[model samples]
Structures are given as structure tokens and as C-alpha cells.
Target: MSKKSYRNKIEIAKEKEKNKEELLKKIERLQKRINDLEKSLNKPQNIQDKTELYLKHPEEPVVTPTLKKTVVNEQILWEINNSQRATKGLFEIKGNYEKICSIIPNALIIADEKGKIIFWNKAAEKIFGYTSEEALNNDLLNILVPSEYHQFFKEGFNRFKDTGEGPIIEKPSEFIAKKKNGNNFPIEITLSAIEVDEKWYSVAIIRDISEHKRIEESLIQTHQKLEGMLNNAVNTLVKIIELRDSYTSGHQKRVSELAVAIARKMGLNEKKVKLIKIAALVHDIGKVGIPSEILNKPTKLTDLEFNLIQTHPQAGYNILKEVDFPWPVEEIILQHHERIDGSGYPRKLKDDEIMVEARIIAVADVVEAMSSHRPYRPGLGIKKALEEISQNRGILYDPKVVDICLQLFREKKFKF
Candidate 1:
């Protein structure tokens, strides 16, 4: 084919693709309107303001209430079970359904379109402390639903009455429900819309979740207690390190404070920030093995003594490695001296090879060590400490950690 003819074919194909896209967009818009119309159909129509609502008990002998009953005598139940309008779907009501509802652990209630109770199972009686006789012919909202939830029922019941559809159908939701003595308790309720002889009915299967909630609260308290004990153990280790090196008594704690602040400013999740805090608090644990004379030595230390000091990171790692922490605590301690350019001590790890936790502690360690008074020299001051990290941002330390540290001190007004 000629070049001009091929170009024309390509242009035609492009136009066809554009038309297909526009058609799909129009279909999506039409689908949204159809969904809105279906929702509107859920509004109530032709529902009576007052009607007899019956409450039936299929398990035991009948005690008929004289309230001009509108309910599930055997004929209405037969209508529900055998109606041409009844479709087999979620929570389908069938023959012997009342026997099953009566035996099930959950409380079962079936209300007519007007929100009047018609069926109350044996479990419902036990949960709500209402007999079938007392509960029968009563408005479901007035009897069992709490006042706070009345608005939802009023809105929802109308939709179910009109179109046999509502948000509460086909799924479970949690709410507070009223019991017999006027006490409110948590409940997990699953509702469904059923149609019998062209009339929509609302069916609910509710479970009292008071015990589940109590167990959840108990577990939270137990977790908090365990957290307290873990913190106490970490503090004891901090004290051990401080007691051994008097010149750096609060060094580990100050580093931890700064490291945590930097981690938070960097937008790390709380779990990771917590791990950094714990590692920073005990980063120098290996120094505990070194002689105190060298650790607290006055004036500048000899080369041999300085070499011994570098071994502290590995020493801290060895001691901490034996612990079974959920985080990489020992690794962070080992790499705290590591630099992005592989200039750090102990292992000489570089860049991405080092853990982020170690990177954060390294910056905190340097700032605290230089700013605080040491047995060998007077304090270097915070300005000089900031300059040290700023000078070697990417070369000696992590760039991101450095930037956040700078922001924490400069912009966030973070304190050690």
C-alpha cells in the first residue's frame, strides 16, 4: 500500500478508539443513574399506619395475646414459605424455619413493613428478657432498639417496606440495643429483606457481643501490663551502662530522646520509631565490657585505648544479640558507627548496606557526644555538633536522617 493510504488507515483506527472510550464513559454515567433510581425505589409506599402485628413462638405451646393480632399464624407462615413472590436468597424463610430460628443461638426477629414485631424466637426472649407474648404486636423500634438508633430504624424500615431493600440488609453491623431492664448493650445484627405475598418484611438475626467486647478490653489491659514490664527491663539495662561510665551518665538517654524525635519528624511509623528508641537507649552496652579507667580517662586517650573504644559497638552487639527482640536491635547497635561512605567503625558497613535504624542512632550519638561534657574535653556546643553532621551529611551519615535531624533541632524545636 502507498504511504498516504497507510497514514489514513492509522487515523481511522485512532478515531475508532476515541469513540470506544466515549461510549464507555457514557455507559458508566448511565449506570450511576440507574443505581440512584434503585435506591430511591426503597422508599415506603402504600404501607398502613396501623395494622395488627403478630409475634409467633414455634418452639413451645402458644399463649395468645388479645391485642387484635396481626401476625404469623400458620397461614401467614405458609404464605411466607410457599409464596410465588418469595425468592430463595439470603436468610431465606422456609418450612420449619421457625423451629430453626427458635433453636439457634442468635436472637431472631421478623418485623412487618411498618416495623411491628411478628416473630420472636426463644433466643430473642432470653437475650432481651421478653416473652413472646409481651414482645408480640409491639413496634420493633420501641421495644428492642435504643433511642439513639431510632432515626436509622425509621429511615431504614421505610426503605424495606417500599422496595424490600436497605443498607442494613445482607450484612452485619454493630449497634447498642436495649434489653428488658432498660440497660443498653452492644449487639452484632444481620438484617435481611423478605417478601411474602407482595409485602416486604424485615428479618434480623442479632448476637449479643457484650462478652466479646469484655474479652477485647481484657486483652488490651494485659498487653499494656506486658509493655510496662518490658520498659522496666530496658531501663535496668540503661542504668547498668550509666553506672559503669560515669562521665557519660545520661548520654544513652539523651541520644534516645533525640533519635526518637528525628524518627518521628521523618514520618516513620510508631513501631519503627519505638525500635529506634530502644536501640538508642542501649547502643553503647558493649562499653560495659571495657575497663572503666579507659572509658572515663581524663585528657586525650592513647591510640591503643581509642582502638579499644571502637570495639564497644561490636561488644554491645554481642550482648544484645543474645536477646530475642522482635526488632533488629543487635544489628542497629553494631551498625551505629557505620557511615554512608563506609568510614564508620567496627564493621565499616556503607550506604544501603547499613540498616536505617543504625543510621538514625549514629547521627544522634554524634550530636550528643559532641554537645555534652566528656571526661577528656569540655563540651563542643550544639552549634559545633550541628556543623559536624552538616559537613559530612552524605559522606559520614545518612542524608535523609541528617535532614530530619536538622529540621527537628532547627524547625521543630526538638530537645535532647
Candidate 2:
């Protein structure tokens, strides 16, 4: 009874193993049949049936035509692998070009070699009131160039077409271009030629530079107005300095008169003459900051007091340097006390460093100060004044500027 039962259990186990092997072989045959059906459906006529099957299911998986295109060549497969990067780069360039056109507030056009428009950004629509579709087929010259420039446009275009060269060599040329509303406006146009498929095309970047030109002109006018105001302010400041020190009243004016005469004799230009005149008027402006007691001291200045008096020129530079006067008032004040051989106070600039304007003013300052009475000393007459400069030509005065002063006093008979 036990042997029979063991034999029955063994037969059942063997039957189960045989049934499992039969099921595995059936699954393998089914996979092969599916693969063969896919190949058969890829044929031209069977494709319609496969599409109908997909349509019936709607969500059934199927390969796309794009997948076939991606495998067209090894180069294409590599390009497909990098397609996301390529697409992102293209979108960035498009966005940049759009942003540029948006900011410019003018029409921009890119044309092929056949004069067919290819690119028309947003500002082109805003300015010319034309859509990208309308702009694409239009001839650029016909759209923007006025009737008068037709012959000129033809000549230039033909020249570029024939020789791939022309006279429009600069970055841009300022010209008038007509708008869609038939109004004329100024434009600055820059053009560069590009080639694709062995054909020449142009990528011209156009901007309305009229506003920039207007701004530049306004700045020039403002600068001129500011210069005039500074001159008036300086003159007023000097008058106030003179009013308090009545004895030195008319001192600067007389020096300026003599300085002008000497400068004319020296054959200086109008600009130099003007600089000399302004320098003469403000040569003693530093004395304004000096204490009135020291300036009008009846007794002789002590060594420390005299050292304090010598700081006037540096004070004058500090004051005038920030005033925005067209004349170099800072240099004039700095160099007025500077001797020709570097032997004067506060930056003793010698030779060419001492501007000719300061040299002329220096001579005039001494002549005026010596010929007129000061708190420090009584007046030395014109004869003694002439001798002082003559004794120290080149050593103290610039010889050429000094000679002019001597000639003005002696030969020209110019007097205060």
C-alpha cells in the first residue's frame, strides 16, 4: 500500500514539470510571431491597417516617422542626441534678437541676396505699422528708400552685386528713410554682408539715432551756458573782494588791462588772451581767505605771519578748482606765484609747466602791485616797475612774455 502511494506522487510531479515546459515553449513562439507581425505591418500597404488599429485603440504604442528620420544617417543620430541643446541655443538667439529690436524703437530688416526680406522683428511693426508676414516679401529699398534715392539705390546695389564691394565702408551712414505713413525721419543704418549657399545677403541693423544727436547738441549748449554763468560768478566774487579792501580796488582791473596789451604783443591766439585775462582778474583772489589784519597790517609781517600770507595761492586753487570755469583757474592760481626757475611758493613749477597765461599774469601782477601803494610798502613809480622785470628776465619772468610787457610800456606807450 505504501509503494503504490509513492509511485502516484512521483507521476504527478513529472506531469507538472512537463506541463510547465510546454507553456514556456508556447510563450517563446508567441513573441516570435509578434515580431514577425511588426515587420509585416511596416510594409507600405499594411501601414494603413496598422494606423487604423492604432486609431481604434487610441493609446496603442507605435513608432513615429520622426524615429525613421533620426536613423537616416550616423551624423543625424548624433545630432538627434544633441537636439535639446541645439533647440535651447536657437531659442536664446531668437530671444536676444527680439530684445534688441524691442529696445531700438525703429524698424529692422534682414534681406536675402534676391532682396527678399527674411527677418522683421517687433519694433519694425511698431515703427512701420507692418506685420512680419507683409514685410517678408517686400523689397527693402521700396519700403524705406524715398523716390529721390531710387537712382542712388540702384547704383549702390548694382555695385555691391557686381564686385561684392562698395563705397559704404564705414560702420553706418546717417540718412533719411521714409516711414509707412509717408513721413521722413532720420535713421542711422549699419550693414554687414553675409553669405549662405554661395549667395550674398545683407544683415543691416537700423536705428533712429535722431534722439542721440539731439542729446549731444543739448549737452553742448548746456556746457556753454554753464561756462558763461561761472565767468559772471567769478567776476562778482572778485568785486566783493575788492569792496572790502578799498585801497586795492581797481587793482585787478588795471592788471588785466596791462596783461591783455602784453598778450597781444606776444602774438598769442584769442583763447590764450582770454585765459590770460581771466587769470589776471583772479590772480589775487586767494587774498580773500587771508586775515584782514595780515592783509592790511601797518607794521611789517613777522616770519610766521609772512609764511601764513604765502598760502594764498594754494587756497585760491582749492576754491576755484571746483567751480567748473572753462579757464584753468586752478593752474593759474597755482602758477601765479611760481617763479621761472622753480624758486617760488607752493608747487614752484618751472619752464613749460608754468603756463604762458600764468607767466603773463605774473608780470602784470608785479607791475600793478609795485606801481600802486600797498599796506606793505609805498608806491614805486612806472620807471622803477619797468626796471624790476628787466633786471630779472628769464631768472624770474619768462623772457618772451617779459619782453612783450616791456615793449607795451615803453614802445607802445601803454599806461594804466
lDDT of the candidates, in the order given? 0.73, 0.68
- Candidate 1 lDDT over 89-168, as tens digits, reads 11233333444454556787878878889888898999999999999899999988889889977887887788877786
**Measured by TM-score, how close is model 2 to the native structure?**
0.49
Candidate 2 lDDT by residue in tens digits, 1-416: 23355457546634533442233223223322333334433444444564554345432222111121111111211222233543454454445545544554445566766677877878677666668988887998898889888789778877665444556622567788888888877777755554333455555656665655565566668767776887888688778878767655578888889988889888899888887888777777777777899889988999998998899898878878888777687788778888999998788788788888888888888888889888878889878898999999999999998888888877856998
Candidate 1 wrong stretches, greater than 4 Å:
1-93, 99-104, 110-113, 147-173, 191-203, 321-328, 345-353
Give the TM-score of each candidate. Answer: 0.66, 0.49
Error of 2 at 295 (Å): 10
Residue 310 of model 2, lDDT score: 92
